[model samples]
Target: MRNIYLIISREYLERVRKKSFIIVTLLMPILMIAMMVAPSLMMLYSKSEQKQVVVIDRSGVVADNLYESAEATFIREDGMSKSEACNIYNEESGIFGILYIGEVVDARDSVQLITNSSSSMLLEESISSQIEAIVEREKLKEYNIENLDEILAKIETNIELATFVNNGATEDDGEMESTSTGVSYILGIVLGMLLYMIIILYGQMVLTSVVEEKASRVIDVMVTSCTPFQLMMGKIIGIAAVALTQIAIWALLVLSASKFVMPMLFTPDIASTSGALLDGALGTVTDTGYIATLFAYLALFILGGFLLYASLYAASGSAVDSIQDSQQYNTVIMLPIILSMIIMMTVFNDPNSPIAFWCSMIPFTSPIVMIARIPFGIPTWEIVTSLVILYLTFIAMTYLAAKIFRVGIFMHGKRTSWRELWLWLKE
Candidate 1:
């Protein structure tokens, strides 16, 4: 017990004290948040010099509807031929484009944009769509309906859907559990991928640490005082603690940035730009407590997943003397994790599908798939059952892996095989 404690202490402190850890722990949150916000920020602040487009309107009806926008100014040139417009466009100094509307009003292909320089897609689409709308509105007038403009204006509508979950609502609003499957899908995918990354990273850390220790004969000195099970368990737990610590710190820093730093970063105009988008997002969230619950489960799953795999990683490490030799084992360990990601992708469409349900219930894939399902809402029994199965499987796997570890650490030099591992498990 004392030896295990000492090993755990050594493992945890050895990693946390590194310069790399400190720098990454501090910088990663800021980088991630910045990346998330950058595109929106660029769109909000980006500006283009107003383009001067000379409009030669052969179909005079269409030109009346075209208007000046932030990106462009349309100067109406009447009674001008296409060749005349092109000649003037070639002679002009500041004209960005010459837009020529053709004699045929109904042909969509007749309108041409003649530009010397490359044109923006936004400008081209805006012109094409506006002209199309004008033509459609004019064509509708041929039906001779009374007050057609007013009728069209009155009929245009956008629907806001308020989603309410009717199945097994246990929260404060027991009768109506409000939720958004879209929000659920986004949150689920993000959290699932996050868990996958953490498991791969920290699980590999355990395996590599074990391999290094064995290669240098440090495990030999350490095992004299500790049982193989104790040593393996200690490494797994200690590394998990380190991973949790790093994640916890990242969460704190990110939250702090969001709360205290974000306001300063988002100017009044910028804030207003994303205001309705944010409101729509927040409106979809029925219960604030549900998000809190996910984070809690996320912690549990991360621990369970890492511990479950760390045993195999440690055993694989024990069976080998070098990091390169661990490649054969990586494919086997990674298969379940990879499958969980594939299952997670499909959970976006149907979280409660038969395949998703079975995958989430299975202990091997549950850690990733279950997180993806929970955001869409799941039965309490299901999550509890999944966790129980996952941890129980972790215990069973650890026992089997320890058998390999106990035997493999001393068998150094030659490569280990699946048959040999099977024999060790039997012994």
Candidate 2:
């Protein structure tokens, strides 16, 4: 027990005191804060460059209908030949382009656009859309209905539907919880990916740490004092502690920056709605309370997933003398992890389907699949069952891995293969 504690302390403190760990831990929060704030700041402060378009309207009927907008200003030039307009356009510094329509504006070949340089799609689309609207309005005059344009203008609508979940409760009150499929999908993907990465990262850390110690003959010296199982357990638990510490610090920094710093970035004009925007963006996107709940489950799944994978990783590491020799083993371990990601993407659209439920019950993929499902408000039994299966599998795997470690720790230069690993397991 004391030896394991010493090993754990040495592993934890060695990593925590490193400059790389300190730098990444501090730097990641600032980068996250930038990502959250950048788009909003750009939308609020970024200005579009104004353009001036010259119009040579020979149709005479069309020039008056063309109007100015935020993107460009249309100036109608009448009583001028196309050549005269071209000359003036060539002499002008600010003339973005010229719109020329012949006596028949409806004829496609009769209309032309001349620009000082290549034109933007936005400018072309804007001009084409306005002309299309005008032609449509003129053609619709065949109906002879009065105020048709005004009626059409008034008919356009924008609707926002707020969704709620309460099993059978009324839409207005009494235990009804507001829900956003869009926001929850985003959260699910983020949390699932977070679990996926930490599992791969820290599990690989265990593998590499074991390979490195064994390669240096340090495991030889260390194993004389403790059993192979104790050494492996100590290393696994110590690194798990390191992973948890990093996650906790990151959550605190990100949440603090979001709650306090981002709101302050809003200008006085938008400061009033800043709270609402910060809370849920477009309102009722998600309840802020779910953040805590989601992260708590994230930690649980990360730890469970790490322990399960790390045991296998430790055994794989013990069987190999160098990191380069572990590639085949690494590929085998990653197969289910990759499958879990694919299943996660498909399951997002229909989280409660039989496929998702069954996949969440599988110990290999449950950490990711279950985390993704949780944001959709899955039942409590599913979460508990998945967790129990994951940890139970971890316990069984550790016992087998410890046996492999005991056999392989003293092995030196001999190359080991999967067939040999199977024989060792049997013995």
Candidate 3:
């Protein structure tokens, strides 16, 4: 055990001392911030390039409203045909586009949009939506509805009901109110991505380290001082510590950036509504409270989940003598994480559904699913149970991996298989 600790320390220090590690540890946060800010900056720059669009409204019902709705100066071409409008729009190179609304826009009516300038999807969508709103309003007017408020009130319907539980207690209007679903989605995505990147990146690191040692014949020298099991444990523990260090740095950077850096990137007039991120907020799509809780759950889930998967990756590395040998087992290690992400995507839609519950309880998938559900305010006992199961699962997986690591590191000549793995387990 003492030998393992020494080996672990050596491995950790050796990797941590590398210049590349230092560079990446610091650069990742900046890269992440750049990725987040680029889209908003691009959008801000694009708004200044708006151009005038000509509207030829033969319908006349929605012309004025559509022009105001488009929020662009409209040159009224009320009597022009589609061809005439297109010709004029072509002559004006700087104009944004032309909107041709035919009489009624009925099944027989022709509606045409002509643009010589490069097409913008956002512009197209906005125009389409505006036209749709005007058409709907016109239809209402045709039905002798003089007032939109009256029409809206007549169409709107509401009903209320209460339910009785098995204990005869009334279930009132107790629907869970969410403050921000967008925040919850971001939380789930962040957790899923963090887990994914950590597992893949560090797991690859382990595999490469093992293969490098084996290829260079350095394991023989290391074996003289430490047993295969000790070497494996040392490598895993050391890498895990490094991962923890990196994660801590990332967490600190995120907290600091959110409080200090974000304001500089975005103006106060257009501050983004996207809120706190982490796994627990996945279900809190409509609630701000969920965003607050997400960070806490995310911290716990990420810590536990990273330790769990990193152990597996390290074990996989020890089991193989070369990168080619490791490739075969990589899918097995990655499957749980991939499946957990797929499960998380649907968790928000139905937090209490049977599929969500089962997946959340399963050890392999629970770390992610439970975190995703936490923002939605799951029962306290469920969270406790999931954590306990995940803890036990981690212990069991690491112990089994350590066993395989002991024998497989020294094995040579052929690739290991499931049968060999089981045999190692028994040994």
Best by TM-score: 1
Ranking by TM-score: 1, 2, 3
Better of 2 and 3 by TM-score: 2
Q: Which of the two candidates, 1 or 3, achieves a greater lDDT against the reference? A: 1
Task: Give the per-residue lDDT digits (tens) of candidate 2, residues 1-427.
Answer: 9999988998889889999889987886576445445545654566656678888887776778888875678878877777888888873566887888888878867778888877777778878878878778778889998999789799868655646666777755556665656556766777788789889988998999999999999999999999899999999999899888887887777667655665566545574444432323322222335555766788888899999999999998999999998998999999999999999998898999998999998999999999999978899899999999999999999989988988888888988887888888888
Which of the predicted structures, 1 or 2, would earn the higher TM-score when compared with the native?
Answer: 1
- Which residue pairs collide in model 2, if any? none
Clashes of 2: 0
Please provide, for model 1 over 5-111, each residue's C-alpha lDDT reduced to its tens digit, 9 standing for 90 to 100.
98899999999999998998888667655554454455556787788998888777988888888778898887788788787777356789888887786677679
Segments of candidate 1 deviating more than 4 angstroms:
35-61, 70-72, 75-125, 158-186, 257-277, 282-291, 349-352, 376-380
User: How many clashes in each candidate?
Assistant: 0, 0, 14
lDDT of 3 by residue, 1-427 (tens): 9988897788789888999888988997676545444444554554634557888887776678865433455677887777876766685456777878877675454566677767677677767777786788777777785677677768867542322123333336544332344444445556666666766777677778877887677887899987886777677778877777776776667556766665565554443332222111222322224333555566566656766776777777767777877877888878988898899889989888998998988988887788777755578788888878887888888888888877776777677788988898898
Q: Which 10 residues in a row give candidate 3 its minimum summed lDDT?
A: 277-286
Candidate 3's displacement at residue 48, Å, is: 6.5
For residue 26, give model 2's deviation from the true position in Å: 1.7
Which residue runs of candidate 2 sit more than 4 Å off their true CA positions? 36-47, 51-67, 70-72, 75-136, 162-190, 266-279, 282-288, 342-361, 372-381
lDDT score of residue 260 within candidate 2? 60
Which segments of model 3 are wrong by more than 4 Å? Answer: 31-49, 69-71, 118-178, 261-299, 348-352, 371-380
